[model samples]
Target: MTSDPTSDPTPGSTPDPTPDAVPPTETVRPDWAGIDRLPTLDLLRLMNAEDRTVPAAVAGELPRIAAVVDAVAARMARGGRLVYAGAGTAGRLGVLDAAECPPTFGTDPALVVGLIAGGRTAVTAAVEGAEDRTDLAEADVAALALTPADTLVGVSASGRTPYPLAAIHAARTAGALTVGLACNRGSALVAAAELGIEVEVGPEVLAGSTRLKAGTAQKLVLNLLSTAVMVHLGRTYGNLMVDLRATNTKLRERARRIVAEATGADRDAVGRALGATDGRTKDAILVLLADVDAPTAAQLLKASDGRLRDALERARHQGPPPA
Candidate 1:
């Protein structure tokens, strides 16, 4: 039998025989018997077919995901932070999402946080019993000093994992918005959080290996949550990532293309606008489109709260900030 990836049960330990105790993600499918005996191509096909079902499972939870997105956006607008906490693959995914926000949305790294159960060490290697340690979860949360304006998302495929469940409780107690992203129905994590998102991806191709379908489901929901919230918070301008940080050569080129596309400016004009605005794509677009100087574009964007659309409308109303 395939062992649950989230936990390290004692060697030769028998699974609890209670039917209700077994989550669908852990239930072994009789049809998948002798999957190892199949040819390599057939094995690949089986896994591919299973992977295709993840999107639909995620779709089934869109309403819940939307609710969480709206709530997170509202909180973040009020100076709240978004925090993700989990263990193992779930924890790694949370950290990955949080790390991308700075480059993707030009957000402060501290604005979105990811906390794994075993801390930094667990990120690269397993830490025995870390998932079962509720104290670690509480301490990690305490360090955040979370307030009502904050949000903590507990990610756990099994739903019953102690780490994320503790995180949800801790966040809720602090009056922060609590969201549980889980793969099992009627899970403790879902029921405990103020907002619950359960994307039932069912059993994995390898039976109890939640890192397959369950991980995919969590990732899809997380992408939806973070991207939608960022959009609502004015991180994008008409589907363009105007606030992206051009920290690398590729991103710098992308910034130039963004400015040109947004303003229909020539390459030279785009380069000049970007130069004038200190390489800020949104400011460059405003400089080209609003017929304003770089400093005036900065002031306009500041007044409009970094929203390119709002700044443009204000620039039109004010008529290019005098001479």
Candidate 2:
């Protein structure tokens, strides 16, 4: 909760003469006054009702989200990276999404990056005054060495967070595509970037605790952004993650099931196909569906830029590689 300037001032610290207008996420709801007096069930119901409004707020930003996804996909197609920068809850969310991309969509760990204000330690513990450090933000962006082919998304609930704003400015200066994701409109963070997505989730149930609805909105937006970009980059085949990296026993079993589902093959055939392809699910599917050897399937996938559907079409048209 933010301190009221009129109520009290820190020792030896004078309040600013001109305070900025309160952000929607920071504003208290008059109707929610004395919410502490409510029963547990009533409180739960109130919070749940507020949570339901988040999706509609996100829905209103669809066109903006689509544009950012297309832009990010094009850059990534050329080997560029997608980076997310924020602080606190926003920062943690970005890191989580980035870390998941490799296992879920078979992307290089370096291809999607996340930077939080105050470095790695802040991810688990609060680093006091870290979010206010613009220098740290600039240094973080500099370390990435971003290029025009890269995209950086700055996330914040208030739209005025100094860390993400500075990071966005530094990325823009580096010729990278800059996008701002915030829960409030007309924010400095939004104006600093080339593209802006504001979900406008309004006030949270507990007033300024943006980690509730704002965090949810940011997570949803990041989900849409990363997932849709992967789809456009051919990491998926008809809603299936064709490029999934199965690194564990469960994932290995999943890989077999996916190959079976895609090829309509029995378990034995799936096992044989997976073995021939070295357990590569996409290659196994291509080998079965296109009636090609493992080596030919690999070549087709490479030619089609790892797009399973395209490789299958090419293989069908070319008949079979030499017997």
Candidates' C-alpha lDDT: 0.89, 0.90
Candidate 2, pairs of clashing residues: none
TM-score of each: 0.93, 0.92
User: lDDT (0-100) at residue 9 of candidate 1?
Assistant: 55
Number of clashes in every candidate structure?
Answer: 0, 0
- Give the local distance difference test score of model 2: 0.90
Q: What is the C-alpha RMSD of each candidate to the true structure, in Å?
A: 3.9, 3.5
Residue ranges of candidate 2 with Cα displaced over 4 Å: 1-18, 319-323
Candidate 2, position 232, lDDT: 94
